[model samples]
Target: MFTTFRGGSSGAWRVISMSPVTGETLPAVPSLSVTHAAAIALPLLPSSNAWRLAGVASHVRYVERNEKVALVAVQAGLGRPEASHAALIPIRKNAAWWDLTQNERRRIFEDKSRHIADSLKYLPAIARQLYHCRDLGEPFDFLTWFEFAPEHAAAFEELVAQLRGTEEWSYVEREADLRLVRERV
Candidate 1:
């Protein structure tokens, strides 16, 4: 399925904060909307009005059979009632990262960075979904969406910090941290 994230003046999610973690940044939007469809068209945002990002929900990459099994066993689904807090992080890797073969990149991502292993600890607490956009000519390579309850916010921060400190993050050329909260009726 294709998921599209739209940031604008109104949405089901209220944007709380947006800060650049590395290179470029996006204009601040008050809210966000997430949509899913089998076929979707990219919309052109009028400069200061809004922004949209889309990515496909594909098979997990850079993971071994064992790791995949482990994730499936513990990972929680998104949009849980209590998972009101969310983050949308857009990341772009340097050309050097893309030049490496899949195995080589996997080694850095898992063997060196322990991305999957470390993340397992925070499992059901912080549910996450990853979207790939490199092939779509998008400015960012990956868009990761994470959701958690208010009480788990600290844990979420710790998780992000740990991932960023890893060697794998060295390949990231641009990243933005966008935090949001589900709109209450």
Candidate 2:
């Protein structure tokens, strides 16, 4: 199993290096509902790209039951990345949080806290990959990945602080932000 986010897991990040990694794709089942998508562990063919790492989620009941966020290339001139220094943050919301109505959650998420707006300020500089891990039986309900150049490191730190300080974070029961670096293969 992979390590937990921030520093919750015993596997705290000390040094980082990425050579080549091999793992199962675990193709999501076509019949699986978005709410149940993550737990589909049924194995599928492995990806050809040895450098690629894959994990999967979504937001909203309607959207989650249907499509996910579209995949797009990292916009150029966004960050001054000298090398691929990355961070993987896995987060899980408390069960009691889900018991609330959708409108109730939205009020706190947007009106009370600006989770999306705060992060948007970073833009193309700090590239991100968001994975919903809830349905997968994983410890976390969401796994968010980030990569940035050394120059924008401070921006990333500020963005993180802005998020964790929000009222929305009160629902977060578990979280870990692990740092990493990619080595040339």
Candidate 3:
């Protein structure tokens, strides 16, 4: 009864998740502090509705791509509550979004959209990672994972609200928000 996303690039990426509906099993499902999953029909990840759950792990920043997100922007939750609460948000851009020039999209994402500036306020409190799933050919373009303590839950919600209300969000044709509460080992 567990789910596992492909982490650690050893050349092969694995897609392992318990099939809740079918009752399939993954014997090697590791002991996870937090996990999020969506048993949805792939190919078409409709925005109006997407089964979502909470999860963990982060690697890089969306803006700087390979560069790491500023230490001030995310708190690893070391020696604290990294598993207290978590969120996995999947977002897919519309066709028109891809049509835009790189510079144009960057302008909207940074300036008019204010996606970065808005999120800066809630940093460290809400640990997050922006996963670009587009290249992987996953349904969503980005899988943004977030973790925070229960005390900062409200702040996390506010941060999401701010980003969702921005102009860049308009390109998000499909979205799935997975909320998760970690179970103690």
Best by lDDT: 1
How would you encode candidate 3's per-residue C-alpha lDDT over 79-115 as one tens digit per residue? 2445467665667788899999888887888768766
Worst ten in a row by lDDT for model 1: 40-49
Q: Each candidate's TM vs. the true structure?
A: 0.96, 0.60, 0.62
Which scores higher on lDDT, 2 or 3? 3
* Position 116, candidate 3: lDDT: 67
User: How well does candidate 1 match the true structure in TM-score terms?
Assistant: 0.96
Model 2: per-residue lDDT, tens digit, 1-185? 33222221112122242221112222221111112232343323233111112246343332221122321332333123463566665677887778888878877776678655455557678877567656656655766777787788888879887888888888887665555654431
Q: Which is superior by lDDT, 1 or 2?
A: 1
Clashing pairs for model 2 are: 5-176, 5-177, 6-176, 6-177, 38-136, 39-135, 39-136, 57-132
Q: Which pairs clash (backbone N, Cα, C closer than 3 Å) in model 1?
A: none
Candidate 1 residue-wise lDDT at 24: 80
Please state every model's RMSD to the true fold in angstroms. 1.6, 11.0, 10.4
Q: Cα deviation of 183 in candidate 3 (Å)?
A: 1.1
Q: Given candidate 1, what's the lDDT at residue 178?
A: 98
Q: By TM-score, who's the top model here?
A: 1
Q: Give candidate 2's whole-model lDDT.
A: 0.52
